[model samples]
Target: MNGAKVDVRKVAGEGVTWTLLATLYLRAWESRLPEPILGDRYAAGAVERIDYDFAALRRRIRPASNQFLVALRARQLDDWSRAFLARHPNAVVLQLGCGMDSRMLRLDPLGKLRWFDVDVPHVIELRRRIYPERGRYTMVGASVTDDGWLEAIPADRPVLVVAEGVLPYLTADEVRTLLARLTGHFTAGGELVFDASAPWVARVAEDFRWAPRDAREIERWIPGLTCADATPFTTHHRRIPVRRYRALYRLIHAVPALRNAYREFRFTF
Candidate 1:
């Protein structure tokens, strides 16, 4: 809720979940900027409520450019989501690996559609404390790769599956299996939107487990899953404010592989 505050020091100590705090912090930081890309006030509020070592995390992450990129990525995803929901008001939205993201609040599609935020248990518990209860919005505490959770969600309506900052962390096989399961479950057919890193970026980012050279490569992984769009982050590099960061993005854009080193992809099944 809007005015709720909780100590999240223990949750912040977990290894994988720790990354959520960094993302939450970045969104909050960017929201405070004079002209923000994602202006997520809910994120700013959540950051304010959660008591953690954000100062130390900020120092470690050195979030100058990261803050911009994170907000921009979120803004892009939000735009796509809004477009999808507008087209199908009765759609069901599944946000996998949702973490502490305030997308449901930011979108505020209450009563307009069904929304589910799925993540691991501890993260979900933290989210329960931070976010207010809303009609037609559910929080499922299960890993995205888990098959059992899908059985509970209604599949009769159009579905929009979103997995931002999640797929690359999954093994190639896991990514393939997850997408297949999602498409299989939602027989009515819907869209899937998510961002991914290129192979080179994955190689350098030791934590990432899978990265595709081409976004369309996923078409081979799942039959009937066609890539609708693949937009490189560098395509919007001019939006970055800092001169050096913008220059870095321009340099990346000049190189073919690096151009899509990080990009967003949309697919319809």
Candidate 2:
């Protein structure tokens, strides 16, 4: 697997929004939006990608499961973000592995909280064209692994770390290192929120097939992070026979039983 070549910058635009995973989630959210939020171009950008290649993405990602999980995780992440902002209005909030997400606008904090979006150089470069970095919201074009930008985050206030649909891309050891860095640096009550893919997804992503190339890589070398609270995000799709589960089953080329093996987990460290 060419895990080494999976450019972090590719994570910025269509690689994120153009996939079945993101397109399906946006369609559902757009359908539910009240007119006031429509003017927000972040959401519009994602929806545009979907409208552009609705057919190709749908064919590759095979929507049903990806859409359900992404939307569910979005709710979890937004809720945690807004709650933290309410308490530590001046807190530093980091969105790790933030793709073309509308999080800054969705969880618009009312105070001096510094919201930083951290991703690879290419992704941040693309984002620069769309969202301007203001006093409150900022963009960092550094890979999460490198420590150079850790200083960019305020060491004073507690940081609420958020990773949605991101952890799976990294190898287990890298994930552990990232978590240890976060917890060791922050005080208690400063939490990390992120999701985990089932071993099934890891199996499919063995070569970055549909997900991150490193999914399988991390499982072996790195031990899982042990946190104050690590719980699986428990919510299932409407009950349907295994044969009928569309999205989960679409990756049959790799794992034939992948359809019956759908599972989602969310954890903190």
TM-score versus the correct structure, for each prediction: 0.93, 0.66
- Which candidate ranks first by TM-score, i.e. highest? 1
CA-lDDT, candidates in order: 0.84, 0.55
lDDT winner among the candidates? 1
- lDDT per residue as tens, model 2, 59-104: 6665444444455456556666677667777678888877667777
Clashing pairs in 1: none
Candidate 1 segments exceeding 4 Å error: 1-4, 11-16, 109-111
* Candidate 1 per-residue lDDT over residues 63-127, each given as its tens digit: 77788778878888888888988888889999999989999888864545688999888888888
Off by over 4 Å in 2: 1-42, 49-54, 109-112, 187-189, 206-269
| Alpha-carbon shift of residue 51 in model 2 (angstroms) | 9.9
